[model samples]
Target: MTKHRIYTTSFASVYPHYIAKAEKKGRTKAEVDQIIRWLTGYNQMELEAQLKKQTDFETFFAQAPQPNPSRASIKGVICGVRVEEIKEPTMREIRYLDKLIDELAKGRAMEKILRE
Candidate 1:
């Protein structure tokens, strides 16, 4: 099977969709950024820099600060696939972000979404 395009997709291109999804459900951009930071360790300035550069998803995660260990505890279906069951490392990382965003859009409490 051919590889998916999302791995090479620019994070900048995808960022807006995530924001829109969350905002449509009453979540703020700041809240979206907060969960992203909790997952990737990027501060506001760093996230801005990445978006400004149009970094690809691979590079975005590669250069991210060490992910919170607790992220492994995130579990559930995203796009109809169970995130924890994903075997591909990159896809799993992508789904982790997807799951977090899903939680935010679903109005999950921040502390719980962050796995605190």
Candidate 2:
């Protein structure tokens, strides 16, 4: 089978879509950044640098400062797949981000969304 393109996709390309998804639901870019930082440990400056560098999702996640332990508490379905059930580690990380974004777009409070 052919490999999925998501793994190789540039985070820069998807960043705008994520921002738009949250903003459409009355969320702000800062909230989206917060969610990302909570998951990947990237501060605002680091995230901007990654975006400017056009980092791919694979590299972005691979080089993350630190994956939050609380992320394991994020239980939910994203694109019909249970985030906790995803077998591939990389895919699971991606889905965790997706689930968080979905929660943010659905108006979930930041504390709850961060699994705090």
Candidate 3:
């Protein structure tokens, strides 16, 4: 079966949209960065390096230093599909991120959004 096009898409390409969505809702880029750091455990420098490298989604998630255990708590629909119901590992990770961004855009508190 053909892989999803997003698998090969550079994470950097989509990151701006995540920031834009959050910023449009009166959120800050740092908040978006916090969400990414929380989910993937990437420090600021490491996250910047990944963005500079233009890493694809597959490799970006594959190389995550320590994906948070709390990410499994992320649940909701994104693009009409339930995030928890996504069976493919990579796709699920992507949707987990999408759901978090969705929550941020909806003005969810950072504490609750991180499931802390």
Model 3, residue 50: C-alpha shift (Å): 0.3
Query: What lDDT would each prediction earn against the true structure?
Result: 0.91, 0.93, 0.96
Cα RMSD, each candidate: 1.2, 1.0, 0.5
Candidate 1 residue-wise lDDT at 81:
98
Please identify model 2 stretches exceeding 4 Å from their true place: none
Write candidate 3's Cα lDDT for 2-111 as tens digits.
99999999999999999999999999999999999999999999999999999999999999999999999888889999999999999999999999999999999999
Q: For model 1, which pairs clash?
A: none
Give the candidate order by descending TM-score. Answer: 3, 2, 1
* Best candidate (score: TM-score): 3
Clashes (backbone N, CA, C under 3 Å), per candidate, total 0, 0, 0
Model 3 CA deviation exceeding 4 Å by range: none
lDDT, ranked from best to worst: 3, 2, 1
**Which regions of candidate 1 are displaced past 4 Å?**
none
Each model's TM-score, in the order given?
Answer: 0.95, 0.96, 0.98
| Best prediction by lDDT | 3
